[model samples]
Target chain A: MQTVSIDVGDDGTLSAVLRGELDFTQAARIVAAMEAAIDDCRPDSVRVDLAEVTFLDSSGIGALVRAMKAADQVNASFVVERPTLVVFDQLNTAGLVDVFGLRRA
Target chain B: MIPETDSGYLQRLAELEARVDQARLSPEILSERAAGLLAGRIGCRIDEAHAHLRLLAGQQNTSVASVAATVIGALEIRRSTSLRQVRHSVEEALRATDQEPDQPVRVSAPDASYSWLDVVQQMLNALPGKHIVVVPVRGDDGRITDYECVAVSPGMRDLSGRTGPQLIGMAISTAYPDIVGGPVWRAWADSLTDGHPRSVEPFTYVHIDNGDASEHLLTVRVRPVGPGLLNSWVMHDEQTRLAERIDQTERLGNLGYGEWDLITDTTVWSDGLYRIYERDPADGPLPRAESEALGLPEDEPLRRQAAEEFGRGETIDLTTRALINGKVKHLRAVIDTVRDAEGRPRKVYGIIQDVTARETSRRKLAEVERQLHEHQQDLAAEHRLAAQLQHIVLPIPETPVDLPGLRAAVRYLPAEQASRIGGDWFHAALAGDGSVVLAVGDVAGHGVQAAATMAQLRHTMAALTMTTTSQPAELLAHLNRLLLALGVSTAPATAVIVRWEPATHACTWSQAGHPPPLHARAGVAVELPRPAGPLLGGLAHAEYGTNSLDLAAGDILLLYTDGLVEHRERTLSEGTAPVADLMSRVTAERRDYPLDVLLAGLQRANPDDDTCLLAVRRTDCGNGHD
Candidate 1:
């Protein structure tokens, strides 16, 4: 389901738009795409957009954490944006909202 | 048109006349003349007359030319004026030809001996298999020098590719000099000399082509016919190879063949047939009645159909079951009959194929399919039972109930699919300390196990609230510890628990990996800030904290499981936005019995998970000291 699409901004920020059900099935693919984008762009900042994500299970949460870690390893600032209420609730339940820098946009 | 008086022309005429006289005595010319004369006398075709002469020679076991000579001699005697004399002379000629081995009988018609070769050639032309007639050419010392081929079967060809008329007059010693002293040549000479049949055992005959030699194993049989020997050659390896091929095919195909001669009442079964029936070859073929009795009773109709088709002179190809040695086997029989000239069955031939392996596997696959269907049915039944148990364990109240300082209404929505009944549940009741205890919990997973865990957790919370302190944080901690102590079989769960004190107008709540409750007031709704607490059964020493919020009359608080705001097609916030907006609108409307209305208005975002919702509203009737 078109798991991730990446765009590099002029300010050295890499924005990756994630789509479809972000469960165990798409978790590995999402992480790999994010890592590849981070390695290729070496951006100053990274933003993962969960605006189109329809579902998030525990595995999806793990993938987001892994992506954030990948960004950290590259000395980049990572932010998660535009999570639906259900996804936000899930992040909050896992106590990852603050850790992922989840914010409304 | 030379002048008749020319000496050269006269000498040419005398030479031609002598040549004609010599040709008349030749065997071919003599046989032709005799056949012509016989045809004219009998008023029949010359070919029929020649055939008749050959047939008579065969009956008498003599040469056609000898028979023709006897006929000519009788006719010449008849020309001398007496039919009785002709008959006597014919009888005498036959007797002398039979008795005299070395004597000259009737001037020893030496040329007449070879006249039948053409008739023999005609016979060979009409034959089906490989055959050739070769006449012995005598040397000056009277010993057989060599044999010259006079007739060849139409289908017979030498290694040189010469066949039929091309092989005529070819000396065997020149064409196949390798066999001049071989077993076949010796057999031919011996058969000619003794006028008896002889056969040579299989021997290798090698032919050289362009200095490359190829070897063939052949058998030769010769029978003396007139002044020649009729030789039949067989490729010894081909016959043996053909029989082996048939045997191998039968074995590999799991098939057997049987033939029954109706006229003789004799039955013959191939070796494969004996193997198929698992009978010793020494036992002979099974009797027809016994073999028929082996057919399973269930296949009687198929047998009847086959019999009917057979009676109509139709070939029967049928598959039926047989019980042999107590094991059922599938047999496919293809039966046909050899019919007589009048269309009556003279012989019956049948090929029986053992197809038991194929049939057995087919039946097994069908059985497996039936079993899979029944397994799915059992799973469906289990789902129904699990759903029923879920309803009985966590029954939702139809109307809101009055808690210490609030009106609480609970609604339970099952998953859209019947099999997805889950562990979502809610509890809203008064504790022993005059405080109201409320809780909404969701056990991970579905089916009966989830329902059972939900029941256990609900009962444990109820018991804890009645006997222990009415504190949200303490109660959550206790529930978490209880989940951990219940062992790995108990799935991890999320729950939000709250204790409401009517005297203080204080609502203290805590959650374990659960969403904070939504608080709605005058035209606004917001999710309460959640305290630091991990989900139940996550750690050995997990701590929970409480969040307290002062409530006034007409304030509505909604607590629900993730199913209410979880969907596969959208993010969590998207799913919850509408619910939050609805709560704000409901509070703004200031409708009476807003708790009931809010619960009724809410819809689950994900139909694949069960949703449990608890809505409570602060009422003016409660003994609030705010």
Candidate 2:
């Protein structure tokens, strides 16, 4: 599988491009790498892009939620952008949509 | 024998005699005194006179000397005193008689009594009513019962013309047999059998229409007096009365009502509600904390719901499972919130009911639903497995084969329902000798086991027929053996096999407890003959009979599993007739249609079951067709 990538803008806004599946196998690595970069770069706001995400699960949502909370601890803004309908519905039902500032495409 | 002495001596003698009469001295003391006195007077031995005197004293109530003195000296004085006392009593009585001349006086006597009858008669005659008549009933067994009859003051006998024979000597039961046969009589009889009284006050008495019947629709009061004598009295034109109110206080008070104040954190419970909660209502209302604590731990969600309703100022009617007295109960409560003018919650009121029985029934219903769901799931899983097994056992042939004179196509339609997916199979394989071996079989039931049996039978038939020349009878016999053996040891299968020979232009077929295939030629269809045999596996020693048909060129033969033509709701003949009609129509319309197309058409013909059609046609050599 190809590695998913993340980019940070000059204005301290971070963006992640997720590819393949955000299933169990990839959620942990994505969360860890994005979190480490957020800590090092000290971005003011972060957005995770899920346009490339083929599959998403409860674990994926948990990783995102954890990352959001971790960002909050550091006083950085957190958001998820362009999640699929299925993932969005699951997160909405589980009451994690507002916590992560999730939005549908 | 008079004592000639002074009056004082005489008085002293009298005092001594009175003392002797009053005291209970022993016989010896009497003898001692008598000896002293009579020692000189009586010349015989004093002991003999003393014995005789003691015997006499014992008979009388005084000492022997006192008796002797009374007989000799005091007798005259006692008679005189008695005479004087009698004269004084007579004088008093005469004076009372002078005051009331009609009064009678009698001399009193002891040790005797008047009879009960006399006393009862006196009591009855002394009452102030002149119209009272008392009749005493005497049973043959010597049991006496009394009844009173009161006539209308002057005796209405003149108006009635008839005498009182009907009123007297008649048992109440005999007079009113309807009353005796009614439920009241049975109840009264039970009470009386327990030796208690049952009274019917102001009941209507229907007097038989007799000449001059003045008492004809009288109100009668009845009471059982003694054994079999029912006291019945007739009242003229009495107003009837009845109880006005019925008792239902217990039913109304059974369930309790309650209210909870969220703002004040207070709860008010009715007496019955407290009792329902198994708490004493006398001890104020239960603290809200304690009341919630007493509920089952599992009911915390319901408590939260009730709290939410109170917050929203909404009424909540809910039922929850509770534990009361260490036993699980279903409690039903209808809760309503009283709201303030600003739409704020004031208090939550509810009616709490113990619905343990209803909850138990609901639990049982849920349990039954769960069981039914589990059973359905199990059956569906079994069906899936069976379908898979059937797929593995009798897989569809990838290609059609060229038999000597017949071109054959076979299709197998599985059950429509997911839970009925099972052993329905069709086989069309070319024999080693260039003959066609076609077979279709259905195992009885629909499930994993049936599918497995179908697979086994189909595989065994293929293997057995491979070793022998393709003879329909021989192949069926082998299939029958396998089926019978498997059935005896396990589940069995039903099948039909067709063998076609191009050289002879004839088709030989045998049936083993399977529906016969349809033979259609020139748009005319008929069921092929079935061989004689019992269903495979039903009997240990059984063989299927064979049937044959000569194939004319352009003729079509159809073989199928019975699922295509049998349904649970319809008989075999009913299901087969429709399929046969469809086959006739389809072939007549398009005899030249491809085998696959024909099979698809047949599937369309019956949509309920998985349908299979094996259509075979022998090419005709006439008119240079071949």
lDDT of 2 at B584: 78
Q: Rate the local accuracy (lDDT) of all candidates.
A: 0.77, 0.57
- Deviation from native of the Cα of residue A101 in model 1, angstroms: 21
Per-residue accuracy of model 1 over B423-477 as CA lDDT, tens digit each:
8889888887888888998876677877888888898888888898779888878
Q: What is the TM-score of chain A in candidate 2?
A: 0.87
- The residue-by-residue lDDT of candidate 1 on A1-105, one tens digit each, is 578999999999999999988864576688788888898889999998999986786446656766776787688988889987767768778655655686532
Question: Which lDDT tens digits does candidate 2 get at residues B291-387?
Answer: 5566788878887776565444456677777666787766777877543322333455888777777767988999999999999898777876776
The TM-score values for the models, in the order shown, are: 0.60, 0.41
DockQ of each: 0.15, 0.01
Among all windows of 10 consecutive residues in model 2 chain B, the one with the lowest summed lDDT is B106-115
TM-score, cand. 1 = 0.60
